[model samples]
Target: MMDLLRSLLFVLLFYPGTLLYVLTVIIVSPIGDAPVQAVVHAWSQFHHWLVRNVLGIRIVWDGAIPDGPFLIAVKHQSMMEAVDTLHFAQCPVVVMKRELTVIPLFGWVTRRYGVIGVDREAGASALRTMMAEARAAVSGGRPVIIFPEGTRVPYGTSPPLRPGFAGLYRALGLPVVPVAHDVGRLWHRGFVKRSGTVHFKVGDVIPPGLKRDDVESRVHAAINALTP
Candidate 1:
């Protein structure tokens, strides 16, 4: 009963809080990227506050959060980690699905804020576009983050990475930093979120230019290291 009430309160505050931030982003986007980024940073902080206080959850980091221009491949278990990334990284350019970039006002702000959107069904063309944008982002010294698994999965499952991860890895030529976390254990797709600690374990850096199979194998294992 307490969990249900907390979840309901979070949902009640979440939507309005998100809307306020999104509108702020939209308004400030016309000024410059810096202003937009500040808004996003604030938004991420807001989420952290809610997750910690309202939902009674805590985030525990086991390793150093990677800095500089590296390809960050993360384990995707729930939406919690997605928002958490913004709080963890400074100006990370996240690669998301094209569908997300097509949303109404929210999508506009995401594009303005520099999210790389990929059309998964567009075959090679999508890969090319994603690679190009990723290169530009790296040149600007921003980290590129992607969920190698492509979409969220239930806890305790280790799925093979989507093919696009390999292509992006080859194109970016940046060392890969794999991040494993246990958010899905408490935060599922539904509204009732349980209270517990979400552990984020960052793996060692995987050097670039390895054979596709070798790199993929290492990343797959690293990102699932904490999964049970």
Candidate 2:
């Protein structure tokens, strides 16, 4: 009923909104990366507004966003949070699968945005390549955001993180900021975006140099600590 209408409205509006932002990106691309990112940030902001006003969805941030260059290991539940990161992070270099880079305009602009794309099936060599790119991104003083689970997990379920997360942590030697959120409840992995507040709870910064097992255990617990 209403859910279907809201969902349909969300889908209809999204196409135009994305097109508008893509046009902005094209117009500002000649100016440089910073301006282009500003355009993307504006789009994310608009998305937030649409979610709040049109879809009756709200986003609440419950913890501090770390300062300086670091790695952000996020709980991947929905695309909403991914869009939100464009606004939340100072300047983020997202580590994504190589497949996403072929997504028409999204792929083209994200490459221009300097996102690191990796072929996940490539094994150790891919890990090395990912770390190298992430290192370069952080070197520029921007944060790197990675989905620990490597893909979206359904709401209320926690999955073991992929090895790449630990690999990057060890290779980069930077504090890992674990960000947890229950966005799946609202912006589902399927469709049917529900109406409610999505809470982004940032946990304590996990210091670098921990053993792989320790790092994974700590981050896994910290991210899933959010209640209500």
Candidate 3:
């Protein structure tokens, strides 16, 4: 119950600030002066700070960003993990569910920035679309982030990752950075509250020159190798 109350309090502060940010995005992105992508990316960073502060999550930066464009396959623990990426990476155009675009202002913001949507039910067509987007993002000097598990899994328990992850790595042909961490305990589910540090450890990058068609097994192995 205390966590719920805290979350509500946080929401109160966040909503008003978010509204202001949304308005700024509208003003800046519409005019010719500011590039839409840069403005939105800035907003994402600020938004990350807002949530981190409200939730009392102190983000510790460790490791280095790969020298070239790469693919970032991260373990999804909570919504915070998704938001935190904006701070560390301007690259890694995130791959997310298509339905997120349906959200009001936030959806518009994500689209204007760097998120790529994939329809879960579209099967082969979705795979094709993901390949194209992932490849383009990597080729254009942005790392592409894929949640191999497809959805957020609470801490300590593993969710079986989807098979498409391998295909994405193969199709993109870039270094793969495997990110893993336990953030679920920080942002617990249901009607309670707790606050703590969330450590996101970014592991080594898988370099190019692997068998092109063998993307699936390689992606699965690398993700599994990430220490919990």
Candidate 4:
């Protein structure tokens, strides 16, 4: 089928393209953050091009992308939004699992690029470290993005957020911006991606200093507003 062929081509092109981009990042990393950031932007743009032309998918933004530093809690449905975040935000500090930050060359590049890796199994220690890094990122005027649900879930399913979200919320004391999207409908955890529009709906900003239960409930609801 056309979808299968397109998917195959996409994989073939994406991996090699990513390798080149990674290498570029590694090379420019020593120069300064600006050069590295430029490479990352180009890489994200490349992904957008492939998704639109090769996979026949379109990304539709429903609301304005935030410009200032804030805690961005996004709904994680698939890898599409993971990469797309680079395109939507201006020099965002993404919080990802420590495992991802340990990958060979990619890991080093990620650390150099300012990604905050979270050790999920490290319990309270991990939260402390993540909060520390998030504070630094916010002070630098870069938005910190995290998947509140911790991991990707199937379409139409909304899970409770991980505990670290509230801890980070309290520590950073920054307003939270919830982003809702339906990427799994066309780009689930497999090959042969379907062609359609992936809607990215940005919810209103939630101010800081609310009760843990209240903030969690509001973010959970906002991020899943477009789920069903």
TM accuracy, model 4: 0.97
lDDT string for model 2 (68-155, tens) is 8888888888878777777667878888888987888878877888888888889999899999999888888889999888887888
> Across residues 1-228, which tens digit of lDDT does each residue of candidate 3 receive?
555666777777667876777677767776642366666566567667655666666766457656557778887867667766664565448989888866888788767665788888999899898898777677677778889888777777666667567678767766777777767767756534366676666776767667644554455555554335
**In model 4, what are the clashing residue pairs, if there are any?**
none
> Of models 3 and 4, which has the larger lDDT?
4
> lDDT for model 1, on a 0 to 1 scale?
0.90
Model 4 has a clash total of 0
Candidates in order have lDDT scores of 0.90, 0.84, 0.70, 0.90
lDDT of 4 at 214: 99
lDDT at position 58, candidate 1:
89
TM-score of each: 0.97, 0.94, 0.84, 0.97
Worst 10 residues of 4 by lDDT: 79-88
